[model samples]
Target chain A: MIVKSDEKYSTLGSLESELAISGLKSGSNLEKLLKAGYFVVTAELGPPRGADRTVIEKKATLLKGYADAFNITDCQTAVVRLSSITGGAILVGLGLEPIIQMTCRDRNRIAIQSDLLGAAALGIKNLLCLTGDHQKFGDHPGAKGVFDIDSLQLLQIVKGMRDEKKFQSGEEIEVEPRFFIGAAENPFADPFTYRAFRLAKKIRAGADFIQTQIIFNVDKFSAWMERVRALGLHKKVFILAGVAPIKSLLMAKYMKTHVPGMDIPDEIIKRMEKAKKGSAKTEGLNICLDVIEKVRKIEGVSGVHIMAIEWEEAIPEIAKRAGLLPRPSP
Target chain B: MIVADIKPFKEIMRLVKNYRKICVIGCGTCVTVCHAGGQKQVSEVAAQLRLAAKLEKKHLEVGEETILRQCEHEFIDSLEGLVQKYDAIVSLGCGIGVQMLAERFPHTRILPGLNTKFMGAPTEPGIFWERCVGCGNCILAETGGFCPVTRCAKGLLNGPCGGSQNGLCEVSPDTPCVWQLIYEQLEAQGMLDTMEAITPPKDWSVGQGGCGPRRLVLEHLVEEEKDKHKIAEKVLTRNDCKK
Candidate 1:
């Protein structure tokens, strides 16, 4: 079942079912990683642009105890931010588990392979791969992009690091990191049905977890999850459904229109718009709780990440409403 | 640069309390590099603003637009279609990016969220240190690789002052002694004695001049000038945009 992760979390799964299929032993560290059949724990972290460790330290400290693992993005959108490798190392130093986010836009195959080995040397255990945003979307529109590989190809590289136990050429490193791979999906923005097929492919490739984008509709997400289950891939990995609490009616509309795969029905919008003058945000929070309540009853939802952003403190309250009250100790 | 930091969320919410249709125009450049402005930050800010507005009993129609960049007019013009709809635009970019938005949408009020610090270069991976003062001149050839004009406490250009001890700057512990860097670099290149042979005072006028910017016109003559000019002067080509 979907258990809250503020403290230690336990999943309702026959550990044997997960390990027997994947060939990993029960009581393994991943007994926490895989649950029922789908693995769902995921969180997002971005690289800071200027060099000040304060931001990273604060974020890691606040989130380490709550999230299963957090991701450090590469020069996301290629605007020359801090490198994910450096940030990942900092997280390691801080005792927070981090996922090294690598994008192919800035590195060639040689550099990509080199960075992967370096990441392993740093004892990083998780990875999230992306094709990266185009240079046009970054500060350096004039800068050239190097898309020598994409996410799928990067997944193969991660697998090669473990499976082949070596680099692309067959030269083995002194150490190899076992990566629990994950990829992103936007149900509202994807070509309706491609999500399941694509996720199945990612699972077939090596992804252990799937993190969906900010989800506005829980029922719609469940519908998508049902299809992925029917693909008989239910016993393969975990799926963490993303939840975004609407801060305002305008934000509700923005995600609905601009963000891909984030669908908020008119009824929910009307509920917020029709709420009492200053109570619209309150109503929006309730709407999110309603979705969470409905989603918890669904068969396969692993857990949720409340992207409270500046409103991270409200997470305790939202978690309470969603039946995700912090589970203490065991 | 306007030394502005993203005011805490409550402050931004309180400032724009009246505006209903709020458009958050995030930059995909320096601000993005710093994490103050970027798609993820825009998304996070959009989410945060929504939460704050919810508490205040107001509804804000926030639009998320991350353009190619806020500095380029062509990219700034990219917001033409949606500019008419917003009541106010909260810019997540740096000072220059925010100004670009103001310059483009003069009618629509613009707000800044990040504090732009200085004209600094990336010290290492994600660290940027103030390097160039935009002093209207560059004289790196004589000072090894360090610029005394920018790193020196007194903008000294001649030789090491009495304060340079053990190769550390006297002004601050964090500051590296630029003269020591010159000494090390020159010694490595076997030009330490040659540089010391002539330690003349520098003409600081060109730098301190009214313009207050640097210019480098030392060696402009090149055999491939016509070809270089043709490439730049040519109408922009999209051929290089592909992988």
Candidate 2:
């Protein structure tokens, strides 16, 4: 195909087509690290609920060299916040690679495709597909959920757009949105035995990477990983186990009791409660470090995705204490 | 079967406040099985309305009648004479029956005394649960005879969503997650491979969202009627020749 740089539309189309065919060479640093067989470390930045660019920038700066790439959550828990794309763009400007999380709860197929194109156009490389928390849990319970497609379908759609160079309708795209596809796994959720099988299904659907829900019960997670290993899914996709540092005893108790799908053992909660007032955060970090060390040793486990949540400042220290820092240079 | 529940007595009373004479109609089919709008329930509602009106010092005449099926025109036609005598008709049948009565007795004001829940069978003697939304296109064959559209809280085609825990739905710990049941059933049938296939988005046009007041016409039946007309004409011609 003859490409022209001066033609307004053709230039953009050819540029994207070049990137798409080259296996998305300009992909995120996480993709590079995973490809290079580096023990990767990722973190998350929950974009502020309001229009605060500095919040995202500060978090990005804090996590700059501590982690490979951090994810910008798409309205986590269905509570509306800064758009992941915008937050991701800001992180890119701040020299931090971002994995833009996209949820199926708020957008239909058209919006999802449009946002993918827009995100790719703005230099966003990583995409994490999720079936977001139900709207009933969010501030807008009255809002209609447009799960036009679920996470599995979302993964398939992104894969098609990137690999097949076509839309979900099978129409050819001049410029495909090449992304490093990722999907979420909840091992602690339900029918615990089926969780690994479900992860296999996600991988089959074209998820290049997997990030799980926060792990407080490592034994159960290991059982799930065993199933994943039995299927040899670890060889097909990178599995990043999720860990979140509990800031206080109250937070641990809340996650254990209030959060659905979260299985925090009573022993961990008791340990948190026993900690002295000033040392609770330290105890939480220690527990997180322990989980990280243990998870790193598990076969088929690639890395850890530390979700510091609102406590972004603790991520650097956590990564340092956990011996994950001095991130590998590309 | 369409399961229903009786509307609050106060609501029914308020609906028929202006009418002095009311005819309460019931269906003997699905509603009867559900104990909602059966012959027995019709009498119960009539008695309640009568007592309630008497207590309020209002003269009210509540007549009770039960039909074999309110959905069929023949059974509903039986109430032609009795229906006109009443100022209003209180239908203890499902929503379909209430609408059928309204179409049959255009002059009588029809009020629904029961809330039509869903097309479902009773799990036990008294407790009822929804099993179908009548989306028109059924995929029970693929889902191990379990209807994810009706059972899953999100109506997910490829489920169970993350909310499923210990085979129970996150919406309610009491409610068993239908997808989990489907997975187990499919596994038991040695059909776990079926769950691996991603179900495409449903064709809503064939479902409730497509259009309004859907009807099915049998073309062969119409063709048969035409054939009967031709046969009748030939018989008449032969009879004329004899004459």
Candidate 3:
């Protein structure tokens, strides 16, 4: 039980009231759930490319109670979309929690800080900082990328704003925008031995929690988790294993072959290929549920972040089948 | 050294079509070494321009010249009176040389025949890779001598951003991730701890992010010029008083 379905307000007044209720950093529902020792389930929501609020409203309705918090993506793959902050506000108005994903690909520090403030003011309390996908993968490949600050710096900056009551320039902030900060890690990427150390860097930089790149190979993820546990980094930050329900065999093959920093086991691809025709999607969902089940048993994994890319409809069913339904009250 | 590429012939022709007499000038330093603009290149360009004019049945006079360094005032001064003979001068020099030529001969049209690329060195016989962006503040000592500003696509100070995989950048498979090289270099030196420490945001104002154009003034050298100017000013004032 998060916010009541009928209770909705889109203003700083409501946010201030929510903040006043708890002495916690952000007092966000997700943070409250995590603090209460609830195994969380978060999902990704890609904002529409055009200015159609109904598109998001519909998606929000589908995912209203499935997860502890919904992550509103920021121009994922560098393709333009309705801004994450705007999308977060929409979810806020719908009485749902949103974890706004902020990427370093498009905005500089000035814009980043300004947007963070706006997001917080609009009742957004959770954030996931990332060094976004390269612009070449997007529709606007010819566009200029403005990664004035990397994801680590972004986390540090947001932390400074929240905890220290100051901006990156060391200027005092009157009303600091408190946020439950999160960062993304890709353990599947190269320099495998260094991944744990990198996660430590994110934690030191102010990441309260982390959602890793979509996991396809549990053995590698578990190995990385063992390293994380060795360094005691798992104690410092909440770790969420990222999972995505594969839509089709072609998608599975494409991700394995083309997507960088993604490791899809050959056996997983073969499993999807072997699925009877028209049953690939069901098999994909099963695979996702299997990953979720495996990751849940791993020590130090706080939750599962289901990234159902474009398949938002599957989330409720996945949540129901995974026993993640009836989300705990904040 | 400055790397540059010669402009397309059609663009060069369009730039000089209005001028009855045009001189193609090449720099003898970086451009020569890069085999882009040199004495030999100037000769070839002059020949091509002359032949093109002949084919077009247009009456045109083309001259070729090469200076030791078009960027230096002394070298450009050597061409002083002779440069005025041409209606326009097409400079096949790096951007600095083209601007230097334009500054010296303000009245004559100084057209650029080459697009200055970057400050870099050749990796092999023909391929040149950018090594520095002249950000003014150098952090190479801490970075194991690999420049993230010049090499990393995002110019990230704390980097190798998830895009680094298999030692290559996500931007392009051809481009090697400089952070990976820096990490390895630091690891070899037993400085992996250096990579772990959080590097703060860079002061970009020292680089291109600064206001307007940037200049480096050597105070010791500039003081001597100021003294000379003072002496000349005093001499002029005395002459004026006498007059």
Candidate 4:
């Protein structure tokens, strides 16, 4: 049974007791770890395209004790997958904390609000809000993009629902969906300069934590972290630097060339190319470990979000090699 | 001005494939300034249609006319004698102009030669960008003059969305993220505090979603009411003369 924390749940008034035993609290283990100043480590899992609970369960079980919490991607890259809410709920049932990802690519405000309420009712605590990948990149290239509210406003709306106990329309919610709000950032995308200011806007919008896009260039990321620290934004929000284990030289080249926001460095690509036959995966893991180590040392970075896309088996080893294993208890 | 772009030459030709005699009407106002619909544009379109018909071995008679404004009945009445000879009229104005032509000449087929894009101004020669969605609510004072409704991909009122990078939109690298421009302008003007205040969801009722065609009428402009005011002035003048 999930016991709601009295301190945070007391704001629920009389409804606290009814939800105390079953409902998830606003504060999550990830939040607890960040609050306690412990170096947090989280992982991401893309929900399968088909509805097979066994696949989700296996992945969650693999990541259970290693990651503080695992994020279930919401139609990542515009490809429809098992709903993040359902995947998150399944993970919850399997004794794993899940960060349900929600994107504005597919839903309008009514659907977004309804799903948020449903997710909360299902005992899902953590939510990572995103403006999702454009539908042009997805399997359904002809699909319409429903960006009714972009990620920033979604963050504000969720924060309002959680903190002010009111909907976007100002209607009072009988039972507020207490969520540890999170938002994503791509430091390498463009105009290369305003990333930190955009992050500041997200923080002001009530984002409790931030997860960045995949980091391949340590120098650029460190520079961004320096800017983030300069603005004193590090103290305001928990920033989780994103690190993805490149599986092969081909994958690295594809991401560097094809992906819009990814900034994979030439040196890393050359290093991967120099890898001996059958050693590319090992080299990739080494690159991931090196990035984790370098990112952990950044002043403003609070944690590392490991996105071993479709490579769940590498996470346990990557976490252990990065010295992020032996997960702390909240 | 409501800016527009001319449809592709082939598409325009295809639209008038059935008509042997076509009259192309261009607006002298907004479309003219944007270079989409004007006297020159009308002549160019008429020339292209004649050339296309010649190449296709079809006999075609193309005429061109420029009106002060196609949306007004006064300007549209200029086509009274000229329209009867043509099988169809291709309007080079915005959507308003095309509809106005249709409303005035119900029996004549009205085809839009230009695609009505948006209410915006040309940033430079031969370039125009949409600047307004006509949400009927103006928040330029709060936004440092950059409109999120038309400029932002998601129409977010609060601030920049996460897809913003290096000050560009996530949808396309070519599109400069307007929110970044707003932020810089606000920061430069020392009015960043205005951005902190959450802008409520717009009241769309006054906008495109609320109802039928929007109308605005000044009560004092009514002709009958003006006559009453004229009579009242006359009575006051007579009383003044007696005094």
Candidate 5:
């Protein structure tokens, strides 16, 4: 196959043919890290709302080598964005591993299965199954939501495709997708007592790694981890503590007041507001480092997932400060 | 029960503007009980149409009628004689009632005066909550009798989607998360073990998924009528043979 000088494959057909010969193994590097007993680090990469390739390419350049893998978000917050498959393909072309996030909000089973096959064909190894944010919170509120299968069902379907070499309908696949499946859990959400049980349910649904919602309340997260340990679930899957840096006082207040499933403590808000005039960003970074340090010491925590949102530049410093630098090669 | 809300008066007036004579028909069952479209509402709509037409100096004829049940043929048969008296009909019944009126009086125009909301029941004096989606397959046995198919915004069957906070849905503070409710109910009953099992993907074909309209026929009733027809045919054949 003759490759382009620019390395930008225009069509998926060509990409598929090229990947077949590239000898890129169909498994996640993050999985390898977890198995090797390395404290892994991952971060989120939100796709642009429009067809702009440079937006992700630029962020990928900054995020490369700072984390084991990047989670390419699929229409995060229910707003329309570049498809996760396309974004993951772009990251793959740039030689970065992407854990493509699949949501149950916009596609039915048929579409979901087709996209899974495509993601596999594009050399995506990691898959995160999310029920996604409700469409009411996003730009298109009038759109019809297609939650044909929730996240648990999605995990089962992916697991069936991978392990059984069969589709959701029990039909055989010519070549099954090999994905290190992941699922999200929230410990701060209401009915907190049931949170660990839900995590156990995700593990049963074939979640290889568990990424939790961003944590600001360390005491609550520690308690949740305690429940997880009580159930003996830590042995089953890798648990990554999700943490995000608050860039400003406004973002902190908004996340506390507006965002659902987030627990922002009053002290964190007070700390953010009291940051020295020109050094709030540094304070936010410090707060994030503190969280990583705290969660890293927790018994069951296997890694930390830093979601810097639009502040990708802060990841390298955060990772270095937290002693997670020199990302290991799998 | 089916819940419906009347369309705005301006929209109703616009729909009936071209017709010189119109009749406002209301349902006496579901819509009546819901206070959306009943005898009282029909009279009020008719009077409002008259007053608006008079103010506009437009000559118009308006009539009012309330049927016991617009969905049933027997209840709406009383309007047979009055069907030709009006140019158009504005039905204040649920979607099924409007369709029934349209199906019965094929030649006349049947316009809906209310927007059919959902299959629900009154939660309070003025609030109604959707309870069932008629998904054909019921998993309430496993879910502690709470219908997540209808009450949940995403219709998630496995568990709450990590968005429930303080027992309320993430979509709205006023909307209680059905999964949280289910969890609490099951926990109280000491049945939390039931929720641990993963619910498989729903069989959507049982509902009106890819299939068209659904129909239920009582096979025994149909067989009884067929038996009578067979007897009549046998007697006719004997008479023909004798001739």
Candidate 6:
């Protein structure tokens, strides 16, 4: 995603913004998932930049068991896909709840709004909003960008359709889609005091839950989340810390250099680098598991999104080792 | 640079009313750059028209395609294969580009999806401003770079419109009087005398007059067509068939 304009740090306010979250206040999918006491692991499967589906299928199968819902990303990183709609349908047929991640980058308000209805007709329940990366960073550098609406606006869009029964067109929406709207957060990337406040804005904008960017430092996330509670965010929102296992030294370096607002501590980098040959990647993976184990204990965090990338098979092993088996139902 | 803006789907559906086979034509030029009339817009328009047709319980065949620049002859030639295949073509380009398509597809009806707004320039990233009017004359050397004809509400040349009050257009407080803007610029450049130098009356015959206007700046190209309507569209469908 385009490195967003510098985030304005503020306190997560009282739930005074009338975001109309009644559809999800009780019997929503997120409500059900949380009440079910499953650890509620969701993973993002960004379609490869090329036309190849072979790698995607391999990754999809590998991540199947570890996640309660497997997300098929729509043009993630501003790169085009083999149609996330079709990919989501494929995942649905494969016997999984497909969380379709949509962005405001490629479609206008109508297209995005209509696509949600399309997804609903096909039975996708989990929806994630993103103000995707600009087109320049993707494979198709020349494609025109369409930021018709941003992520917070998209959340409000869904909230309006489902709760308010209205479309962007102002006509009464005939076929409103039911969705568990999830927004994104970056605690480590944001300063400690400002993180919760930004998250509160998303919550007030109608996000049912938030899936944060990967967490490398649990202490930093927990401290940031303590402010999340002090600001009273614990009562209104569900926050999920993002967890992506570092597979190699190169991946860690890439997160540091290429990924904006992401900080991979030198200690973690050194820990990954110092491991003996075959064990380094596994050691890095263990750090993610440990981070999740501790973050799970953090009072405000609602869940975790384990994005294992190509090494999806190790997710189950990692979760099992962290004692997150059968995902925390409730 | 493609210039584009979104429009309601129902309005577009009404424009292509009686056509059985509708082809959505996208401009890869300014419309694409504006994120409006490109492959994505074409696809969405095609999809919406299909959805509308399906809702009406009519299986109308709708096709989608785009060309490099609908305003140019070379670009129009690229659509020969797809053009003849549809009963009507809905163009998603500015007024100039749409008329060009109607001229190129002489035997087919050309419909317009977007209502061309103004001769504007990208004011900010993803924003455009109505800056020029192609008024068949330029006084950029004397008035600095601002064109008084387009920016002024009254198109007054010599000085600010009497209706201006406190640097704002009386018609709309939000709009700044162009002459006032020009005055500030000239004063900044020590060229404020340009406003007092009484210019001769404008020659109406020099510009395109009624609807469209075209003019050339000193550094740009211009085309003065004596019979601009020579490529006027003829109705391919008889009145009895479609009311």
lDDT of 5 by residue, A99-142 (tens): 99999999998999999999999999999999888899999999
**What is the lDDT for A272 in model 1?**
75
Q: How far in Å is the alpha carbon of A235 misplaced in model 3?
A: 0.9
- Residue pairs in collision within model 3: none
Candidate 4: global Cα-lDDT? 0.85
lDDT tens digits, residue span B1-243, model 2: 999999999999999999999989999999999999999999999999999999999999999999999999999989989999999999988999999999988988999999998989889879888998888888999999999888876777776877787788876778899989999999899998898887765666566656876788899999999999999999999999999
Per-model fnat list: 0.00, 0.41, 0.61, 0.26, 0.79, 0.00
Q: How many Å off is the CA of A101 in candidate 4?
A: 1.6
Candidate 2 segments whose C-alpha is farther than 4 A from its true place:
A1-22, A48-65, A89-95, A142-144, A326-330, B211-213, B225-243
TM-score of each: 0.51, 0.86, 0.93, 0.83, 0.94, 0.54
All DockQ scores:
0.01, 0.47, 0.60, 0.26, 0.72, 0.02
* Per-residue lDDT over B200-223 for candidate 4, one digit per residue giving the tens place of the 0 to 100 score: 556666876568777778876787
Clashing residue pairs in candidate 4 are A190-B166, A191-B166, A192-B166
In the range A1-330, model 3's lDDT, one tens digit per residue, is: 332212121111232332224457888998877655567889999899999999999999989988989999999998999999999999999999999999989998999999999999999999999978889899999998887888999999999999999999999999999999999999888678788998999988999889999999999999999999898776677788999999999999999878888999998999998999999999999999999888887877778899999999999988888878788778
Interface RMSD, candidates in the order listed: 27.8, 1.5, 1.3, 3.3, 0.8, 22.6
**Model 6: how far is A108 from its true place, Å?**
0.7
Segments of candidate 4 deviating more than 4 angstroms? A1-27, A36-38, A51-54, A139-144, A187-200, A223-235, A328-330, B54-59, B156-170, B187-205, B210-213, B217-243
Report every candidate's CA lDDT.
0.66, 0.85, 0.89, 0.85, 0.88, 0.70
Q: In model 5 chain A, where is the ten-residue run with the lowest total lDDT? A: A3-12
When 3 and 6 are scored with lDDT, the better candidate is 3
Ranking by TM-score: 5, 3, 2, 4, 6, 1
Model 3 residue B90 lDDT? 94
Docking class of 5: medium
